[model samples]
Target chain A: GGIITQTPKFLIGQEGQKLTLKCQQNFNHDTMYWYRQDSGKGLRLIYYSITENDLQKGDLSEGYDASREKKSSFSLTVTSAQKNEMAVFLCASSRTGQDTQYFGPGTRLLVL
Target chain B: QQQVRQSPQSLTVWEGETAILNCSYEDSTFNYFPWYQQFPGEGPALLISIRSVSDKKEDGRFTIFFNKREKKLSLHITDSQPGDSATYFCAASLSNYNVLYFGSGTKLTVEP
Candidate 1:
């Protein structure tokens, strides 16, 4: 079985800093997604990529950007961090549309 | 308006009791509904899912009751245990698009 590896399990950034989180999946799934999970609030889509070099905005795409540099890797960047802005960033991959999604361990981001 | 809503933001039940998490969606186009379980500091993982055509789907101790007409669905965990304590999210989406809109989430705590 393969796993989705997310870098920097915990990240602390200064306000207004540009922070990037990386994800690598070994399942070789075609579709990848980035989601922000706030406490109490469920997962909100930030960006998704169906394939390499593709990007699609989600409902909460503002202040965030994502890229599918390669089929096996996807990354998300926070344009400008806000103090006290804390959330968990999750990376998921699916084999096909509407299929079951496999998730990574997730990266916790905290802006100081 | 919140696209999806999950009831009882937090639930506490004794071990071996039944825990029911309710969810309702306002989007009529949502053809797929899924329940995801997330432990603290971890990513949400798909627990169970159901399509609009199906009224119910069950796997092991987890069961999903879907009502297409009412645009509502729910997850029921039988014989709830302390280990089942976590945040649960209900998500909805169209079959063609992988984008899923999730509810605020329901935190379940099973006591001894």
Candidate 2:
């Protein structure tokens, strides 16, 4: 079984600052995704990549940017932190076509 | 993300009872449906899923029931255990998007 790893379990950022969250997967999957979850809310898709150098925007992609430099790694950047914002960003990967997705431990972000 | 509606934002059930979470979506293109379970400070995990062609899918204690015509679905946990206390999310995805549209989530607590 492969695993998805996300760096920096917790993050604290100041308003208007930029922050980046990184994700790495060992499953060798071709598709990866980034999602944001607020307390008591469901996960919202931010961005996804079908393969290296391929990017796709999702419903909540306006505030985030993503990169897929290689098949095993994907990264997301918060363009500008919002004051008093609190959310958790989750990363996941799945094989091509319809398949079950594996998720990584989320990165909790708080903008002070 | 894509207007997937969910009800009973939170639910409480006694141990050994059954807990049902509901979800519905407006996207007719979505052919795959999945449910995820998440614990505090952890990432969501794929619990079970069903395709649009199938009405039901079961895995151990968890079951997914789909209604293609109604554009709705549900997850039922039988004989719920205290360990089942967590948030559950229902997601839908089309073959084109390669991303899942998630519901706000349902927090279920199985109390002893």
Clashing pairs in 1: none
Residue by residue across B1-58, what tens digits does model 1's lDDT show? 7899999999999999999999999989888898999887778888999999899999
Q: Each model's RMSD to truth, in Å?
A: 1.2, 1.4
TM-score of each: 0.96, 0.95
**For model 2, which pairs clash?**
A42-B104
Q: For each prediction, how big is the interface RMSD?
A: 1.6, 1.8
DockQ of each two-chain model: 0.73, 0.69
Worst 10 residues of 2 chain A by lDDT: A94-103
Off by over 4 Å in 1: none
Tens digit of per-residue lDDT, candidate 2, span A1-112: 9999998899999999989999999999999999999876788889989999999998899988999999999999999999999999999999887568789999999999
Error of 2 at B94 (Å): 1.6
Worst ten in a row by lDDT for model 1 chain B: B92-101
By DockQ, who's the top model here?
1
As a whole number from 0 to 100, the lDDT of residue A104 in candidate 2 is 97
Give Cα distance to truth, residue B16, candidate 1, Å. Answer: 1.2
lDDT of 1 by residue, A6-112 (tens): 99899999999999999999998999999988887788889999989999898899999888999999999999999999999999998765467889999999999
